[model samples]
Target chain A: MWKTVVRRLIIMIPQIILLSMLVFTVAHFMPGDPFTGIIDPNVDAARLEELRRAAGYYDPLHVQYFRWVGNALQGDFGRSFAQKVPVTTLIGARAMNSIRLGIVSTVFTYAIALPFGMLSGRYNNSWFDRFVMIYNYVSYAIPTFVLALLFIYIFGYQLQWFPTRGSASPVIPKGTAPYYWDMFYRLLLPGFTAGILGTATTTQTLRNEVIDAKTQDYVRTARSKGVPENVIYNKHIFRNAFLPIASSIGFIFSGLLNGSVFIERIFAFNGMGDLFITSITSRDYSVVITLVLFYGVISIIGSLVSDIVLSLVDPRIRIE
Target chain B: MATDNTLIEVNNLNVGFRFGDEYYNAVEDVSISLAKNEILAIVGESGCGKSTLATAIIGLHDPHNTRIEGEILYNGLDLTKLNEKLYNRLRGNDISMIFQDPLGSLNPVMTIYKQIEESLIYHTKLNDKERYDRVLELLNQVGIPKPERVMKQYPHELSGGMRQRVVIAIALANKPPVIIADEPTTALDVTIQAQILDLMKDIQEETESGIILITHDLGVVAETADRVAVMYAGQIVEEAPVDVLFTDPKHPYTRSLLNSIPNELHEDGEELHVIQGTVPSLQNLPRKGDRFRDRIPWIPDEAFDEDPILHEIAPGHKVRGNSWKYFHFEGEEME
Candidate 1:
């Protein structure tokens, strides 16, 4: 098992490099020029040419790609022409804000979905089961942007229950206890709205998986041994049912990131989503390539982690 | 033949499942008993309710839509009325079950030791260390060698014979007085089947625990059962001492079953005799008279009793009502 994980990691380095190369090629030829937007309009054509040359825009595409790749290998993601800061520093700070939302929403999804799924499945076709099914449909049908807006209106604007815009309070002093609480308070509405969508889909799907697991022979054997219903649900059934949930965690990170684009836009949460959009629209090649490559690495690591965790939970996977 | 010191007595057990507005009886009006140190094999083709009776003996029925009637008397207590709490106390300790598919009978994720020690944890008052030692001893008793290595192995790691041995080890873990084995050897090879049967017989002798062995294999019944009950369409059509069943089989169904087996007299690739038609499904199950009537048309209308009952023909020999009219063995009529 450890060998598989180690080998997977070893293989991932080349994969990540190939992925970075692909993103670099696409972003390089994406129409708008970063130097055209940043350089002064009054500058002479010769000086403008010099700036483009310095940025390696006039070099062959492969040459430019390899130059960027070479700098990236040494941990330099290049300086943003627009922001005038290293791409890593900008993305690093914002990634923390995204991480907070990602972690909390993930916890909420599993903590809420797992038990409710088990109950709905155990009592499949009951009134409560139908209610959960309907709830899943309704929550999933409402688009994430719409839900985010609704939550902002009801919980943020209409009710004054939470802050509507941005991630932290301007009034609270930084590094203070109140600032941390204020940050959490601001995230609650958007976080829950985003999290509940995942919870809804997962809970319903997990209910189905659990229903299937209940019919497995091991469950029948467990019952014959006189293991209590609750023990059977928790010990025998949930372990297998939760396999889908474990693998889903990987892609869900990327899903949540994609979802946050509009959510942060609507909520005014100045995180990676906002930065990504501003950089892309302005054709800020450095930040765009950096964020794009960063997301790719996250997805690869997420899948790897999911595989390893699944192997740990189910012994059958350990040897294979 | 004489059921003295009965360990588990099932009286007129009826198992039915409800679908929509209709209820279908899977096993109806069947009664049997297991005595101390005896092996009672209930033999029939697939879906004969042979397994249903075995599960019902341990107070296990379908999780939903199935109803059980009549009394399962163990220690003079009707197991039918026993609450799950009380049932739990007796189950895995007083009465245990081993199932048909050996692999499915044990949890795939659980180690052999954990599966074996499950009964010990539930039934015995032994500490973990003692349970561990007892598990190895029980493994050795079930004919598993190098039990230390086997204990840590999962069900998939072992062969079918080894898995069944693990299951038998679990059944014997608490030293239950009655063990219900539902087609325990059906999933194994012939040699392993014989070995498992012998091991069960040895266990029965040493512990004096009654075993209710449910199977469709007449060969298994002949080799293992002391008393045999031949079931047809949810009813016990004939039941007698093992010797009498093979020698003086009285029911038309029993006669046809014995003839279906390929024998040495037949040349290779000869078509075997098969009792015509399949067992009746739940919806078409006959509630009165002979359920096997359609399959044995040659027996004549007079052969089926107007009111069907498992009728005793002689000391320790029983057959379904009116089956005595046309009873024959190996094409020879009884005097």
Candidate 2:
């Protein structure tokens, strides 16, 4: 198992390099430069050149990329043009905010989806089953951003339950202790919306998987051996049914990160997605490229994690 | 649990399933009984509802979607009337089934010992150590060499015959009064099939438990079955003691099935006869009038249109419709 994890991690190296390079090149050609934002019309050309030289912008594209990659490997993410701070420091703060919400949403999504899905599938065509199907399709059909706005209106405007937007109100004193609670309060709306949709789709996929697993000969054997219905559902059916869901994690993990983009912006959570929006509009090339590479890294890592998990779930998978 | 009395008596059972818009009967008015320590083999071609009958007798199929009418009396208790709770208690404790596809029937993820231990855990109050000891003994009884090694191995690690042996070990774990082996050796190779049959015979003799062997193979019936029940087209066409049925098959369908088996000990190139005309679809079964129609249309109407019924033509032998006159019952004149 350790060998398989090590091998997967090793394979991820070239993938990360290739992906980062591709993202860097694409962000490089995306219209304006980071120096464009820093340079003023009144500033002298010599002074602008000095700033550009310090930023490594005057170097050849390949040389600049190699330098940036070298610095990135050493945990130096260059500097943000707009923020005028180390890109790593800015990302680190906002990345935690995003991770807080994303992790909570993912855990909640799976917890709700699995049992509900299995039960729905096991009792197909019944009233309860049909209700789940209707709810899932309707939930999935509505855009998540629209749902976010609606939730804000319902809970924030009408119900007066949650705060309107942002990870936390500025009035709240910033400290390590209550800071997470503040983040959770602000994330509740967006996280709830994202989780609902995630639950909807994952439940649909899991439902079909459970239905297939229920028909398996082993399930029939368990039932024939006079195992209780609950035992059959939990041990024999659910464990075997998790294979398709395990394989699906790679896609869902990537989608979760990407889908968080719009939702993150609406909620005013200053995370990677907000960084992406700001970098593109302000033409902060360094920040934009760094964020793109970050996403690429996440995609690759998620896939590796999923593969390792699949091997663990199904013993038939040979690492070699 | 062997006694002078019968263990299970199935009376005029009919099993049917809803096909598309209509309910079609699969096993029609079938009656059979399993005496203590008697090996009763239900033999028929595929789609003959023989397996369905076996399942009905065992109360495995649900009555909600499946319509099963008739009494299945086990120890004077109507199995059909027993609730799911009672049935669950009785299933592994009083009776258990070994399925056809051994690998498919055994859980892929579980260890062989765990699968065997499952029955003991569910049905008996045996402690963990006792269950483990019994599992090893059961594994050994099924002719699995090195029971300790097999106990730790998963289903995929073993060969087809080994998996079947594991299933048998599981079925016998609770020491049920009756063991239903549905085509137990059908999925195995010829040599492996023989070994499994031998193992089952030995187990039955030692345990003294009645085994309801469900299979289409006549050779298996000839080797192990004490009595044979021949089913055709959703009904038992004929039934008799094993030797008597082999020597004097009363029904035309049973006679044709018995004749299809090639005797290796017979003369060389002696072509074996095969039953022609496919078994009709369960949806629209043939009427009683067209029961044994000719394979070739050129033959006279007398070649078919005879509704054969089970009749005793000899002592301890029942044929379908008037076999007492002669073995040429297939050509019997209709009134």
Candidate 3:
């Protein structure tokens, strides 16, 4: 399994490089020029041309792509023309904020979903099961942006429960202990909005699978042989049913990053989603290309981790 | 003279299930006594209620739609009235069962040792070390060489015959007085089936436990059964010693079934007879006295107009018959 993971990583490097080149090439050719936005438009044409040349705009697309790729290989994602900071540093801090949201939501989703899913499976077709099914459908039908806005209105504006705009309090002093706590508190509303919808879908689907697993003939044999119901459910049914769900964890994590784009925009939270929006709007081509490539790498690695976990859950799977 | 060694006395067992609006009785008024150290085989065609009776004996019926009336006396205790906890204690310890498909009968994910150790852990108060030793010993007793290797192996790693042996090890773990094998060898190849049957017989002899072998093959009954009960349409139409059932079958259903088994070694193509019609469905049973004849429209009307009740025909043989009919051999009828 470890060998398979390493091989997959080795294979993904070229795909990442190709992806980086394509996104960089496209962002370079986009209609807007960042030089006019950042450099003074009032400056003479000669000075503006000099600034553009220094920024590598005078070079061919192929040469510029190779230069960026070479810098990226050495952990330098170039300087952002809009922010006047290293692209790598800007993305690094934003990536941490995104990680906070991803980790919090994923943990909350599973903790709430697993037991409720088991209960729904145990009492299949009961009122509880139907209620969960209805809940899943209702939550899934509403868009994430709409939900985030609703939560912000209910909890932030009207209810005065949580602050709506920023990740942390302005008065707590930046980068202090209280600042981090304030950031976590503000992220909670959007985090829970995402978790509730994701967990509701997983609970309904996994409950159905677990119910089917419990009805297998082996379960009947176990019950007839006098094995306790709880043992049967834990050691046999859940273990078997968890295989597909475990594999799906990779998909959920990858999707969590993608889905956060809208959630961050709605709540003005400073994360990868906000970074992506700012880079697109300002035409910061280097940072936009780097962030896209970074997301691609995360997806590939997440899939590899999921496969390894699934192999551990079911002995029949061999990664190699 | 008969000795009083009966372990389980099943009296007038009537089991039925509700299908939407109507109730269908699968087994009606079937009584049989199983003695210690005896192998009684219940043989019948598919859907004959043999397996239903076995499940009722073990209290494994679904409580949603099933209703069981009649006493299953195991050492003078009625099993039907016992609560779930008490019945659970008695199941693997006092009575165990083996199923038809050996593959589906054992949990695929569990190790052979864990599966065998379950009954011992539940019924016996032995420490972990003693339980391990007993599991190894039971595995070896059931003809699994290298019990240590088998202990760590899962069900899918073992062959069909080996898996069935592990199942037998589990059945014999608590040394239950009765082991009900519901067509234990039906899922195996012919050669493996013979070996499993012989192994079961040897196990019965060594443990001195009564076995209820539920099957449809008369050949298995001939080889292993001490007493035989032939069922048809949810009733025991013939009950006799193994030899008597094969030789002087007094019920028309039993006689037709016995004739159905092709005797290639003895009778060289003499038009082997088969049972004429299908068994009646439990959902639509005809009225009394008209059931047997009306269900089999293919059979001649005169042969089955009267519904035959299973009655004693000789000292130890019983059949569903009156005094007029006798078993015929080589075109000669013996009264």
What is the lDDT, from 0 to 100, of the residue A187 in candidate 3?
A: 76
How does chain A of every candidate compare to the true chain A by TM-score?
Answer: 0.92, 0.90, 0.87
Q: What C-alpha lDDT, on a 0 to 100 scale, does residue B120 get in candidate 3?
A: 81
Runs in model 1 deviating more than 4 A are A32-34, B1-4, B264-271, B328-335
* Docking category of candidate 1: medium
TM-score of chain B of each: 0.94, 0.91, 0.92
TM-score of 3: 0.88
> How large is the C-alpha RMSD of every model relative to the true structure?
2.3, 3.2, 3.6
Model 2: clashing residue pairs? none
Instruction: Give the alpha-carbon lDDT of every model.
Output: 0.83, 0.80, 0.81
Candidate 2 CAPRI classification by DockQ: medium
Candidate closest to the true structure, highest TM-score: 1
Give candidate 1's error at residue B7 in angstroms.
0.5
TM-score of chain A of 2: 0.90
- lDDT order of candidates, best first? 1, 3, 2
Ranked candidates (TM-score, high to low):
1, 2, 3
Tens digits of per-residue lDDT for model 2, B187-217: 9999999999999999999988989999999
* Best candidate according to DockQ: 2
Task: Give the poorly placed runs of model 2, Cα more than 4 Å off.
Answer: A30-35, A39-63, A176-179, A318-320, B1-3, B264-266, B287-290, B293-308, B323-335
